[model samples]
Target chain A: MRSVFRVVENHRESDWTHTIFFDREIESTPGQFMMVWLPRLGEKPFTLSYLNAVTVKKAGAFTEKLAALEPGDEIGLRGPLGQGYPPLKRPALIGGGVGIAELRLLALASEEPSFVLGGRTADEILFYEEFRELGPVHVATEDGALGHKGLVTELLPVEADSYAVCGPERMMAACLPKLPAERTYFAVERYMKCAVGLCGQCTCSGWRVCTDGPIFPASTVAQMDDFGKRRRSKSGRWEAV
Target chain B: MIPLPRIDPPLINASGILSYPEVFTAFESAGACLGGYVTKSVGPREKPGNENPVVVYPPEGAVLNSLALPTQSAEDWERDLEEIKLKNAKLIVSVYGGDAGEFAGVTRRMSRFGDAIEVNLGCPNKEPGEQTIMESIGQNPALSAEVIERVRDETDKPVIAKLSPNSDYLAVAESCMNAGADALGCGNTLGPGLAVDIRSRAAILAGTTGGISGPALKPINLRMTYEAYARFRCPIVAYGGIETWEDAVEYILAGAGVLGIGTAFMRKSTHEAAALTRDIWEGIQEYLDGEPMSALIGAAHRAAEGGDSHA
Candidate 1:
């Protein structure tokens, strides 16, 4: 059942991060995403930062419009789409930049996980307080304004048996060598339309990221040669990300 | 009655668009109102496909893609098809092979799971060989007929030939009709076009060339459907840039028995697609009033001939 829901709450998390809470009750799990539509404005997929809520960053044309949206505004939403992060008993949740939005909910849902959140600057770090409530939080900012001053992967405990990781492809790629391929579950992001596996735009290797993953086993990620180095733009051209 | 199958709405999700089994229920619930869903083209073996930038959308509501027909083997697709349940919608499994024997082999194995078998004769990005199979088979009447005849021998279920607009599609359609094809899926995508980013001075897609689809391809597809209808007796499944109710009506008027929606589905949500279907149905009803649905099927051709040509 898809429907148009009114914005109940919109919060500015940082200079660029904004969270919008919808009136709609959509059942979803961590690592899944929603196709947010603003009618004539257009539609794009956003990872769920929390249940029925999307944390957006002002990046492109659609996100710029999404940033300006306020309470009482109506936006069309469909999903809780794609594969989600599975529940893990003891896991490490690692996120980088806006990719942290995909991990926030998973951190809360997990039993007691170590959260490694990374950003370029302290101001860009997201959901720190919320993640802190669930488990120990490790923060890393490139500027050294936050906890550990380096890549979040630097803060990731090398000893964790299993992991849930999300972030820019490079960040995930950096973490890949550290985590056991059989134990890590990576939530990948890609350029998508339909977000339903039909468009073929979000394909990584033979896998449709929209369906086969947004969440992929470490073994699957290990198989994709283009995982960290290349990504397709809206124009469908592959360029170095 | 659209002739190919017993679907009420006469609209279908185009091949290679949305083939995920878990999402079909959402599309149906969202009002996609499709009569059938065509799976992506499956072949004899697994193809990893081309690298990044497989699909791109131009400003004209058109999408260019050089996906290189990436697919799992027919055996894998057959297994996948078993899990997909679309309630009332028919499953039209699309298959592709480098040669007629492979086509027959794949069709024979996949036919039991589908309401129909659609032979993909339109992919534009086949690697350059002594002869590219799609062009060699699709453009030549004898070769096209032979391919269809082989597939026809494999299945009693309806056989649909998905023809390419790049070739002499009308001849292909005519040959397919004569070769025992029950229907024709007209106009795959248009042009093996290239897009280069001026900033990087590099090709947009990893493949460097892809088929152009969307509204920009609609005019070409519409004309192809019109010609196929005028030339052949088989049902025509028209696709290209069908995005609106008016677009749907235009295809029907131009002689498309079943309409395929692709790029438009990319732009609109499932709810919007459903609404569009309802609106098109109502619009068709209003346009027909008490006239039989058949009256509008080839009305343009009848008008062009100044009489009922079929009669």
Candidate 2:
């Protein structure tokens, strides 16, 4: 159920990212997401970055309103829903752009997981210091302003027994060739309405991302024909992503 | 007291929403207080529905969807139904087909899995040819009766005809009841409305036109229920844009024996549906304190006929 929560803390994480902590505690796993309701603006899903916090990147209309939220502002929150990535040994966590927010809780939960963080430029990189505290950190920026100067997938370690990746589908697809499909898990993003699985808006090749997974095994991802090919818009029309 | 296959609370999840088995179990566990759950429309074959954006929420409390009735085959749905564990909720499997034979075949196979079967004769997103099938079968009493009779021939399970509000639903309701349908799922989504994106200069939905639902659809569907109730004796399972306690009470007052909620659940979290259901029940209790449940059911019809002394 949705409960209105007052923002306890609103800290700017970076130039484009902000972290909002709720006064109420929420039980959530690393890869699970919560639907944030901004009264008149509409609802959008965001990955849980901390126990009671969601990190937002000012990317669109909903996120902009979320970013502008101040301490004491009220917003409705529903879930920590969906199947989260299972625990793994010898894990490697990779994230791209704001996708790093999705990996934050996972990294903290892992036993010394290797991290590969990527963004368009150095300014876009998020949670670098926090992630660095949890594991060995590798940074990649397309503009060559940070660690490896290409895609974050380029920096993913080749030897991790199990891997957790969350990012743009293209970025995850790029890493598929190098990783063992059985040992890798990827978190997918989709246009969703009822995060509990009613609205089939997030279905990818018959898989309802909201219920079947927002996080899926790489083997499952490999079988999804629409994985990186297309995504549905808010109006329910498919568009090449 | 809906006439066929008794269900308490008298509310069920509508078709096209909450198709997943886990979702059904979750809603029940979360205390949505539903009498039953209707699976998304299942057909003879696995249908990979229309291209995306399949759903849109207009500024009003309404939603437009062009999902094109995506469903796994009846065999697949039957198998999936086996895995679901509904605590106390009844299962009403909704089946759709391209033709009467297909509908009967699917209903025959799926009937064993649910307490009742809901025949979907009104999906607005069907292609022109398929639309003709739904329109012909739903609007033409003779054709609708034939289809219902064919389905009735397949199973002893209660058969509910889910009709289209876009046509003469009152006639369709009468035909369904006459043809052996035990009940009627009062309506499906209302329109093949277009939602255009001015910036893109294109229709927002992949199918171009989609079924209109949500709060905006309540009045249209309620009227359909009132009319159907006034003309027919079969139980009316009313659905369309019910989001509040008042909306639920309105449906009951309009002669609906059961309530079907879909878009309303979409507007809130699953757990919230339980709260809403409680509020609706409480509202009904408050109203019932003043009148009998029988008096509330078909009150509008009775008042219109100048037979309701309360009116």
Index of the highest-DockQ prediction: 2
Instruction: Give a tens-digit lDDT track for model 1, residues B35-152.
Output: 7888777778776566544555556576787767766666666666786768888888888887888888888889888788888888886532323455667767788888899999
Q: Which docking category, incorrect, acceptable, medium or high, applies to candidate 1?
A: incorrect
Backbone clashes under 3 angstroms, per model: 4, 8
Report the TM-score of candidate 2, chain B only: 0.93
Q: Interface-residue RMSD per candidate?
A: 10.6, 8.7
User: Can you list the residue pairs that collide in candidate 1?
Assistant: A198-B17, A198-B18, A237-B204, B31-B274
Q: Residue A222 in candidate 1 has what lDDT?
A: 93
**For candidate 2 chain B, which ten residues in a row score worst on lDDT?**
B127-136
Q: After superposition, how far is residue B47 of candidate 2 from its true place, in Å?
A: 1.1
lDDT of 2 by residue, A54-112 (tens): 98999888888899888888887777778788988768888888888888788778787
